[model samples]
Target: MIYIVIPVFNRKEYTKECLESLRAQTNQGFSVVIVDDGSTDGTEAMLRDEFPEVVVLKGDGGLFWTAGVNMGIRYALEQGAELIMTMNNDVVVDSDMIAQMYRWHREKPQALLGALELDASNKKPIFGGERLNWKLNTIEHLLHVLPDAERKGLHPVTHLPGRGLLIPRVVFDRIGLLDQKRFPHYIADYDYTHTARRAGFELFVNYDAKILTYPEESGERQIRSSKTFKNYYKHLFDIKGGGNLRDFTRFTLKNCPPPYVPYHLANGYARRLFGYFLK
Candidate 1:
């Protein structure tokens, strides 16, 4: 059976909506495993009272996205799930999303799957298959250039965002869980896709399976809002502030070519500095 794993931290309303959407899905052969990361907003209590069918796991507020997801993934594996779909709790999925992803997986049994994510407010495509340029250390998203009709077909991706990622049991068994310690927040998705690619697993995005999610704020916003050097430093280094130099360095060293590592690191620093000044 397919197991849906969601890692939630607060945002009770969004969580409720996400669960409701999942409950209304066309495919019923799935179970939900929610890892609540110490939400004090009555999320756990509400889930127990309203959504008793869900299997809830509690965390000590320390299990960030990666750890929380890892917890749910481990539990799903123990429960004999053939496929595990990890999604953010802030998104509303389409009714046939699971079925479509499962159908694609059945066709490409050895592939890792993802769905097109659209902006919840504007209904515009936000995240889909991305092309990574190792030489330039840049990523190009296909959402803007690819038309709607072309997006209906499966497309290969170098990296996928973790919002609506689907992984077969075999992929996890071969690659293991995401690197929680190294990438507690960001880059973990990129690392996972890279690891899977190294293991000869193809990554594909099924555009027909879609979800609506909020867009993340850009780094320039954070830089512009930093009023002091202290806050600037925090925004530059803190994981939650969308900055973690160590993790970024680790990802570059691990995945990037030896010669390109320094170039990428320099370029990243230069870009962020330029963004700070431009902001």
Candidate 2:
């Protein structure tokens, strides 16, 4: 059976809505675990009273999504889950998502997991996975863009996103659970994909599976100061380089562009570069 794990922090209303969608899934042989990462907004009480059917794992009051995911992963493993599905608490899934993903995995027998294409507020194809721009050392994917029909293979993907990802138990066996200390938040998805590729497992994006995502505002000016932007790339650099700023520098500009890059990121890159040269 599959184990669906959601990591929530202070998004009570959205989390409740996400769970309700899961409850309506056509494939029902799965257990739901919600990891409440030290929310203070009455999330715990609400879940207990309103959605008692979901298994709630209380965090140590400050564990973020990475930590929360680890908690749920461990629990799912203990419960003998063959496949583990990780998703954001703010998003909902298609009823056939898990079933289709499971069927795909069974057929491929080699793919580690499947990612569902997401529809953001624009109703356009958002993130799934993409070919890494290795020359720039950054993970790049299209937003609001559809895949080319001439693309090489079936269900092709070079990376996976955080919105909707399914991981088989074998992937964990190969790479171990996600590193919580190294990646407290964003880019953990990319780190995991890179590691999985190194371990020789293929990842796929199932276009047939789609979910709705509350789109975040994007622009070059916003990147520098935006919490989401910082959390994503900063952790990515830390994990890939072991705290080396130069490696982080290569990644920041290599995969990201100015219109989409934040202003603060430019400054951060400058400071990091100076620090590197001075050292």
Candidate 3:
């Protein structure tokens, strides 16, 4: 069975809407797991009262996105689910989102990962997957154009937004769990896709299965960092830990050039200079 996993910290109304959408899925043979990350906003009680069929996993408030996702993914895998879908708590999926992804994978066993046409709450596309840059990092565009099937090999990387990523359990087994140390947010999706690529899997965005996403702002410091010292340091740390220095450095210099060049080059140099001191 396909299992859907949602990691919710505290967005009562959004979570409720998300679950409601799932409950109405045109494909209903799936189970759900919602990991409540120590929410004090009556989320616990609300979930118990509203979604009795959902498998609940509790997390400390500090668990953040990556940790909560890991918890839910592990649970889904252990439950003997053939496929596991991870979606944001604020997303309202289409009735056929899960079923379409299931069929895509079933037909294209080589396509190990998939995402949906994630539109905003107003029904505007928000997550159309990533555009590749062999030099630096992949760029994400929120549905710049109408939904159309992307040529399979056109992009070097296909990003599945955690908001509506459907991953087969076999892919998880091959790549292992999502890395929690990547700051619990931001880049984990990219990191996971790269890992899947390394493990002989293809990531794709299925235009057919679309979902609606609410633009929630408060919890994403990793993405909205204001180019501060700490943010730069964290960026360097991620490069060091998650990517090879030389390759990532070249990527930053060549693919991600100009305004972002000096900043990344400085960080790359600093990372190399301080390599001895970093743990």
Best by lDDT: 1
Candidate 2, poorest ten consecutive residues by summed lDDT: 217-226
Q: Which pairs in model 2 have colliding backbones?
A: 136-254, 223-262, 224-262, 224-264, 224-265
lDDT of 1 by residue, 154-199 (tens): 8998878788888889989998999998999777888988889878
Model 3 spans with C-alpha error above 4 angstroms: 136-156, 216-279
The true-versus-predicted C-alpha distance at residue 1 of model 3, in Å, is 0.9
lDDT string, candidate 3, 1-279, tens digits: 878888888778889988999888888978889999888899899989988998999987778778888999888778787777887788877888777777777776656545554446467555556665443533556355434455222222444557777777778777788877643565566667766765778777777777887554433233233545554445445432332354455445433437767766776576544652442
TM-score per candidate, in order?
0.93, 0.75, 0.74
Tell me each candidate's RMSD, in Å, in order. Answer: 2.1, 7.4, 7.2
> Quick one: ranking by TM-score, best first?
1, 2, 3
Please give, for residues 87-145, the per-residue lDDT of candidate 2 as tens digits: 88878777776677767767666675655555555665556557765434344554325
**lDDT, residue 80, model 2:** 84
Question: What CA RMSD would candidate 2 show?
Answer: 7.4
Q: Spell out the clash pairs found in candidate 3.
A: 135-251
